[model samples]
Target: LSMPKGYAMLGRGILTIEGVLTFCSPQLNFVQMLEDHAFGAMIKDFDALKEFRQIGNRLLGALSKSMDIPSEIADVLKMTVRGQTKINLGITEAAEPLNAVNKMVDKLVIGIIDAALLISSSLICTTDMSPKIFEIPVLGMMGYFAALVVGIWLLNGIIRKK
Candidate 1:
C-alpha cells in the first residue's frame, strides 16, 4: 500500500486500540493517547500528575515524527480534515508502542499467576516429598526458576530505565 494510505489505515487502527485501552483501564491508559490532554487535567494526585507529565514528554518526542497520512487509496480515512491530520498521525505512530505495552501488561498478569502456581506446586511437592522419591526437590526448584524469571525481568527493567 502507498505510504499515505497505509498511514490512514494505521491511524484508524491506533484510535481503535486507544478506545480499547480506555475501556479496559482508563486510569492506566489516560496518558497513552498522543493528545491526551483531558487526562492530564483530570488527574489530581501529585504523583499521577508527575507520571502523566513524563508520559507527555515521551509522546511529544515521538509525535515529532511527521508521518504522511494515506489519502486516495479509496477508504474512509482519506476524508479526514487537515486539522486532524497530526493527531491522526500521532495516534497511528503511537499505536505500535502502545500495543507493545498492552501486550507486556497482559503477559505480566499471566506470568504472575503462572509463577505463583509454579511456586505453590514446588512447595507442595517438596513439603510432601518422602525419602522414596529421590528426584530433585520441588519447592526449591520452583523457587530457583521463579527467581530466575524475576531476575531477568528486573534486568530488563533496569535496561529500560537506562
Candidate 2:
C-alpha cells in the first residue's frame, strides 16, 4: 500500500516536531513553540478567527440572557468558581485554634526551660569560680542573660498573640 498520509501520519509528524522543539528548548513548552512558529504561520486569518470568536461569544451571551436559569443551576455555577475558597476558609478556621494552642504549649515549654536556666545560673553565681565578671561567674552571667532574652522573647510573642 502507498505511504499513509492520514491523521496517524500527521499526528506522528506533529509529535516528532514537538519533541525536537522540546529537546532544543527544555525550558519552553513544546505546544507553545508549535503554536508560535508552526501553527501560528499556518493561521492566515487570525483577525477573521478573532472576529468569529467575538461573534460566537456574543451569541452565547444573548442566548443565556434569553434563557431562564434556575436558582439551583446558578448556585451550582457559583459553587464551581468558589469551591476552593470555601475549602480554604474551612481549613484556616479549623487550624486557627490549633495554631494558638501550639504556640501556647511552646511558650509553656520555653518558660519551664527558662526557669530552670535562671535557677542553675543563680546557683553557679553563688560559687567562687574562676573567670569572674565583677566577682560573678562568667558562665553564670551568660546563662542568666540568655534566659532573660528568651523570657523577653516569649513575653513579646504572648503579648502579640493577645
State the number of backbone clashes in model 2. 0
lDDT of 1 by residue, 1-162 (tens): 457988899788877887888899777553355556756666643587678999999888776652322334323454454333334334557878998898778767766875776677566666646432357555556566776777577557757856
Cα RMSD (angstroms) for every candidate in the order listed: 26.2, 14.9
- Please report, in order, the local distance difference test score of every candidate based on alpha carbons: 0.65, 0.84
Give the lDDT of residue 123 in candidate 2. 97
| TM-score for each predicted model, relative to the true structure | 0.28, 0.41
| Candidate 2 least-lDDT 10 residues | 84-93
Total clashing residue pairs per candidate?
A: 3, 0
Residues 126-148 of candidate 2 have per-residue lDDT tens digits of: 99987998999999999999999
